[model samples]
Target: MKIVESHKTDVDNYIITHHYLRSAPAGARLRLWVKDNSDNVIGAMMWGRPTARTYDYNRILELTRLYLIDDTEHCAESKALGMARKYIRKHLPEIRGLISYSSTGEGHKGTVYLADGWFAVGVTRAAAWNKQGRKNIDKSQKIRWVRSV
Candidate 1:
């Protein structure tokens, strides 16, 4: 599979339609598509500033979305991640690390991240937007994974 630049609209649509969350992130700094040898779009990814205030947004980015077609070849996610990392290292040199979370509530153990050389740092506490006017959000505890670029 080959990684290609993708438009936000196309990536968002693909994520919304195929991803389990069924929604796109609000601010994606980079979007990408994974195409098979035959040129069919088989996956999409989005990277953006980390949501947590502790992370240095100028140096660290979060993989906010990653969705692949169910029938793709084995290790496709790992390959896509490897390509994306190389792209970021070359094009966004200021970036020093990448992070992503796997939701325990969603039964995700972060196998793809592990396979791509990311390490689990810790688990985040379950919290939510408790403001009176805000809508309820999933406060699932997540495993934080990180990879140095």
Candidate 2:
């Protein structure tokens, strides 16, 4: 397995095909892929400008999407993520920090980030979403994480 920079369209297709969210990242500035021996993509990740106003957008990149095919060997996701971080540092030298959040609604606990040496900054308060009579509790409490480059 190896990590390589990926095009946006390819990344979008991979994510749509494999990710549980079935959504493509918007405003993506960088995309990476982990390919198996035959070059079939096993994982995909995307980085983009922070959506919220919490950080210096110019110097901070947000990990908008990270999806890996299930049943792979251990540490594959974390290794791909680490390689992507190194790629970002080498290619986008101006970015001095990285940020990402995993949602409780998705049953994520930021384990990958934690394993990769990211600092856990606590979970954000929960907020529900309402739209046109639909009332769903947005239990996606984000567990925010950061890593200095």
Candidate 3:
């Protein structure tokens, strides 16, 4: 397994194929991909500097770019998110609040998020990123469920 700073090499593919964490900027703190021995970009996670979103205020840091190939299994994503939260606390301790967004039908994933201790903050009526139509969360998508780190 390898963890490194995110590069553009296959970023487009990662973004095009994933959600929630995909829309993050090319560069951000902790943008990582967990690859197998073959280096098949399996999992990723990241955190953007605090920014204003549909739900939380800018004072809260945003969790971004978290994705994993479906076959990699949940343990890998958990490890990545756990490491990510740890890294966030280490580097941005002052900014203690962490927020992540997900769609509504994502019930099972939501359970995982909750088990990880993320609380349901609220729902966002607007797209988390409005300018990007693809990122737009229509009626089908729900707002972010936030957590304190």
Local distance difference test, candidate 2: 0.81
| lDDT agreement with native, every candidate | 0.90, 0.81, 0.61
User: Residues 1-149, candidate 3, lDDT per residue (tens digit)?
Assistant: 55555645465456546765345464455466667768777766666664454534444667655677778755666566666666666766776677776666554346556767788867757444545455433344566667777
* Alpha-carbon RMSD, candidate 2: 2.7
Over 4 Å off, model 1 = 128-137
Which segments of model 2 are wrong by more than 4 Å?
Answer: 130-139
lDDT of 1 by residue, 1-149 (tens): 99998764889898889888777888899999999999999999999999999999999999999999989999999999999999999999999999999999889999999999999999999876553553434568999999998
Each model's backbone clash number:
0, 0, 1
For every candidate structure, what is the RMSD over all alpha carbons to the true structure, in angstroms? 2.0, 2.7, 4.2
Query: 27-108 in candidate 2: lDDT tens per residue?
Result: 8888888888789878888888986796888999999888888867698877877887788789999999999988888888
Worst 10 residues of 1 by lDDT: 129-138
Model 1 steric clash pairs: none
Predicted structure 3: lDDT: 0.61
Best by lDDT: 1
